[model samples]
Target: MSLLSTVRNPHDLKKLTAEDLPALAAEIRDFLIHAVARTGGHLGPNLGAVELTLAIHRVFDSPHDRILWDTGHQSYVHKILTGRADDFVNLRQRGGLSGYPSQAESPHDIIENSHASTALSYADGLARAYALRGESRSVVAVVGDGALTGGMCWEAMNNIAAADRPVIIIVNDNGRSYAPTIGGLADHLASLRLAPEYEQVLDVVKQVLGRTPLVGPPLYDALHGIKRGIKDVIQPQGMFEDLGLKYVGPVDGHDVHALETALRRARDFGGPVIVHCVTRKGFGYPAAEQDDADCFHAVGVIDPSTGKPTAAGGGTSWTSVFADEIVQIGHERPDVVTLTAAMLQPVGLKKFASTFPDRVFDVGIAEQHAVTSAAGLALGGIKPVVCVYATFLNRAFDQVLMDVALHRLPVTFVLDRAGVTGEDGPSHNGMWDMSFLQLVPGLSLAAPRDATTLRAQLREAVAITDGPSVVRFSKGKINADIPAIDRVGTVDVIYRSPEVTPTREVLLVAVGAMAATCLQVAERVASHGIGITVVDPRWVKPLDPVLVDLARAHSLVVTVEDNGRVGGVGSTLAQLLRDADVDVPLRDFGIPQTFLDQGKRDQVMADIGLSAQELARRIVELAASRAPALTTGEAEEETPAGQR
Candidate 1:
């Protein structure tokens, strides 16, 4: 029988001896490799975290003592140790196990939001709360080296160092987040990094010291003091100690016995301590280790042997389209530059960086800094395109509004994954960008309908020299070309129901990826002799003057967008029509203003009533509910727009 089956919870793990831990760590690594390959989750990070998590569970009594994960993608091992190993089959599936740490899943699991550099603050607050209550509870936070790139980590660190309480911070330094970590912190950490041989030699010294009769503890303490002197020879920058936090070793993270000893020292310190554990991202798995792109940071249905993705993906992705188009744009405009928040490859900026290495800047995981830095670049007469996921853009909204938009800088923020991104759960969904970016005055936001529009809109967004512009697109496969019949100002008249004259009953305003769904809805409604006009308003913000007339021409206006309903394109258009004094009743269709759970894109969209069938049925009912006789802005009905 396997060791994992015997240990269902942390209490069971506590029963294992020191010798059993290495075997258990090996088993966990194998388990993660196989399980994550099948279920498709964070493979590399969790693989590296096996021994660290095992040591933590063995040292700290969880549920009573809190253990927090910085960006909870590495919590798969924690979940397995916390009696969730059986749920691996349903990982990231609908109503199944979440990809990150879920408080609802178990009391042992806390801090559900997977945003980086946040756990230190949570740990600080939690530790202070426990200290205030006079309750003795060990609070530990395992933060990735990648998360340290963010400014919030330092802000939290400053506060944490001041507080007089036991809060152990494990800096899991695998040295990459999607790609290798940038900035000085990573380099400083690398200087103090010790080899595995040195750690084993230290362990041997510890064993030899323990065998001594009475001077064992004192000799160990004397040696620990000298270790700092030895470290100063290698790297004098004691970054953690300077912050008023007790600093522990740059210990070999893969060594379970070494990690346990370090953790034990941190647990009993009665104050904030930093345990720097150095390990490889893909420690045991050769495929993941060989993956220089991200060390297989995340995978999707991969073969365990070769670490190749098995899922059949269709044509060109929206990312690839942007990737190719941006490179072309880079060639055309030397003034244009690109920036990413440590996601050089994922956001499809690798080629641009390769082509123009001098221009592209990887600003680490700091989105706020990335926005402001792009502003500085724009201020210096450079047109900077800050590319990031729509969800991460949430972190730098204030910076975008003030630093970029307020100054009227020519910064184009190309937000990939701008709509519902499934499988990564609520935190990863890119459904809020359109709503908030709408609030930024003078900022033009474009929502592309297809690969063709994405390239076109991206070009248009970069050409603007006065104010900040945004060209946001969805995740995954690019939509098929939605050929336009006519261009009404900025709007593209994509579809107009055939054989239905004069009286247009409904106007379907499809934004970005919603064009295909709106077509399906329009077709179903049109089969009943109702003339429905579907237009893709490529640029949503600063509503075109043509849309006001389009709304005036139709009896009912329906706006569809792959964004949150609140203050989205639908609501913005409704407000615009009301401001224009047109009373065309609008039925706005978009995602519900709520946190969506983990599921496939189609499943989540259907559940939120954004499905074609659901929208079509609703539109059909709305047509029947309209006034018996419909009138446009004039008594004479306008001619139906078909292929015009």
Candidate 2:
């Protein structure tokens, strides 16, 4: 049996011989390749962390000792060793293991911090908690050196060092986060790698001094100061040391034995210690190593040998739609430029980058910087199209309001995955974009119901110099090829029959990807002899007075969306109806106010009552409750014009 097969937990890991650990690391690498091929996941990061994770577990007792993973993308190796090897078969599947560390998935994972640069603060808090409770447990945080580019990591490091608490920080340095890391931190890491002899000399001196006990303690203290001074002259830039934390390594992260020894050494140190491990991302897998594009960071089910996606054909994704549109706009408009928070390929801006290389800006993993930069770009006579994940855009709320909206900058925010993003779990869900964007003054938000509307809205948003504009679209394929629009506009009724009575019992206003499903529900309701009108409110924000007017004409209006029912388009319309004194019974069909679990997109959406069948049933129930109005009944005739 392989070393990995025998090892079920950290206790099992600790029992392994030094020689056996490397074999175990190899086995784990082989296992990851096989497992991820069968069920796709983050391949590159897992391969990178095999030895580091093993070494960490061996040195520190987990469950009792808290270990927080920054970004959680690199925790796949941690998952495999911690009795989750079997779950790899169903990785990132419905009711299966998560792609990232999840608190609910395992006890060993302390913080499921999917966001970058967040684990340090969690580690600091845990360290303080342990100290407050007089506990003996150690607090360890595994943060990527790439995450150091984020401003929050610096803030955490500064605070953690100020508290001077006993905590260990493992910096997994491979010089990349999504794309290669940018800004000051990347330069520092590059400098460290350039001076390879520094680590070798330090190691030799440490070993020699460690042998003599009488002078060892004093010699090590003096050597540390000398090393710091030497680093100042040679390296001159230790970010962690500058922040007041004890610095260790530039060590070989692939050797489990050496890494364990370093961790044990750091454990003995009294204050916050940063162990900088230099490892290769996509280390063992040749496919991952060869892949310059994020090291196949998050793979779909793929052929292990070929490293190509196994899933078959689909039309262009919503991201591609935006990227193509942006490129077209960039070609047409000289002032147009693009910005992304280290997500160019995923957001489909690669072509744009090639075409307008100078116009495109990859702002690392700094969402805050991307937004503020867009604002600045707008100020400098440029129109910036900021393409970012809907979930990540939450990081730039202040910049969006204070910097952009207050000044009425003509920056277009393109939110990709603006609804339930399956498999990524609650942290990655784009359900809150509508709710959050509602609070921003002078910031107009649009939700495109189809590819055609998305194209129109993009053009419209770019032309708007009156204020900041946000255009959000869902993930996955655009099922239908909508007719190209000549001009920019908002709110279009796609399916309506003039032969039928003007009275619409159920006026369906669907947003983004939910439009097709809403149409299906309308068709089902119509077949059952209930007249319904389906409309796509292209602009979910601005409350589209026209949509409210349509709602006033209906006896029962049901608003369908993939976002949360609370503070969503449905909620906004309800408030608008209430404010206008239009007392129509409106039903909102949306994802509930709860964290969703992982699954296939359709399966997950169906589970959340977003399926056409489920929506049709709800509509039928509503129609059953509503008794038909008598012809002789005198009506108040609540006019929609006055309500608007």
Candidate 3:
């Protein structure tokens, strides 16, 4: 039987011998490569973290001792050690193992810390709580070099250093978050990665030579006693130690023995400490190691041998469409610039960056800094398009409201994955951007339904020089274009019932990708003698005045969107209608205000009752409910979302 089979938990891991661990580590890498390649979870990050995870578990008792993983994608190995290896078959599927640590899954996990640079703050808080309660528990946070770039990590470190309690911070320095970690911190770590370990095997050999019973004893003696001298000369001190936290490495992250030694010393220090572990991002897998683009950071189901994806995505995605259009825009306008918070390729700005290398700025996982910096760029007459994922943009809301919107800068914010992005869990969903962005006073938000509109709306967003503008799109492939019948101001009427009756029953407002679904609902409702007009208001915010006129012309108004029900486009329009004294009954459908489960996008949408059939049935019920209102001559009742 394999050694991994014998281990069911951290307790079982503690039973393995020193000689047995290397084989166990090997088994884990083999298991991860096969399992992740089959299911398509995070492959490279977990693979690099195997030995480091093993050493951490073996040294510290988990659950009792809080072990936190920042940007929890690196916790797959940690999950395996905590007895979840059997669940790998169903990884990332609905009702299966979450890609990140779920507090419900086990007591070992502190939080669903998928966002980068959060674990340190969690660690600092936990340590403070434990100290006050008289609970003597060890707090350890394993943060990546990539996560370190986020300002919050440094903020937590400042508090942690001031504490009297013991806190072990394991800096998992594989020199990457997604790509090679950029900025000053990367250079500092790179210097330390190149430095030799003072107390390891090579240094021990020097000690042996110094005590040799022969010649060259004097020269060897100098080498033996040169540990501190060499450290002061090569290692750049004061980055961590200067913060009042004791520093204890340049240890090999893959070397279990060395990592354990460093961890034990840090654990015994009885104060805040930093243990730097230098490992490779895709340590054992040659395919991942050789991969320059994100080191295969996140991969789909792949052939284990060549590490190529088995399934191919057939159509052009929204990201690709934006990528192509943005490059064209870059060529046409030299003043146009771009910015990303460490994700240039994922956000579809790589091609733009390559085309105009001087114009693209990667701000290294600092979204707040990226936003304010873009404001600075706009101040210099540069039209900066800040490209970021919708979910990630939530972090920089203040900067958007203050630095950009308040100043009325011409900066354009492009939010990719602006809807229900599934499989990455609730924390990764892009459902909140529209809801939060509604609060920005001068910001204009656009939701494009298809590839053609995406290109057009993106251009429209950039041209708005009066204030900040947002062009948001969903993840995955572009739908077939929903051609507009006519432009009624900012609204595009996509569908209208054949016979326009005097008592118009429904005017459906389709938001972004929900246009197709709304069109389907219109067709479904038409079977029951109900008339509906579907329109796409390309720019959802600053709703066109024509909508109020359209609503007054109809008995019922329905809006469907891909964002959260609260404070989103649907809710915003409801407010607009209510303020305009258009007493026509209105109903809006969207994702309920809740954290959604991980699943296929269609499955999640259907589960949330966002499907066409579900919507059509509700709209029919609402229309039927109003039949009595027309006959009785009573004012129509505004339908509550749940009554149907």
Error of 3 at 24 (Å): 1.1
The predictions' CA RMSDs to the true structure, in order, are 5.0, 4.7, 4.1
Which residue segments of model 2 deviate by more than 4 Å? 207-225, 482-489, 497-504, 627-644
**Residues 319-407 of candidate 2: C-alpha lDDT, one tens digit per residue:** 87887888899889989999998788888899998998998888888899999999999999999999989999989999999999999
What is candidate 3's lDDT per residue for 1-644, written digit by digit as tens?
99999999999999998899999999999999998898888888888999999999999999899999987999999999998999989889999999999998988888898889888999999999999999999999999849988999999999999988889999999888788788898888898888665446446765667677664767666864464456667676557877989888888888899889889999988999999998888888999999998887888899999999899775899999999999999999999999998888899988998899999998888999999999999999999999999999999999999999999999999999988899898988898988898899988999999999999999998889999999999888888888999889989999988865546569999999889888889999887788889999998888888999988999888889888877877677777877897778777788877899999888888888888888999788878777545321234254333211
- Give the Å error, residue 96, model 1: 0.5
In model 3, the runs with Cα more than 4 Å from the true position are 197-232, 502-504, 627-644
Q: lDDT of each structure?
A: 0.87, 0.81, 0.87
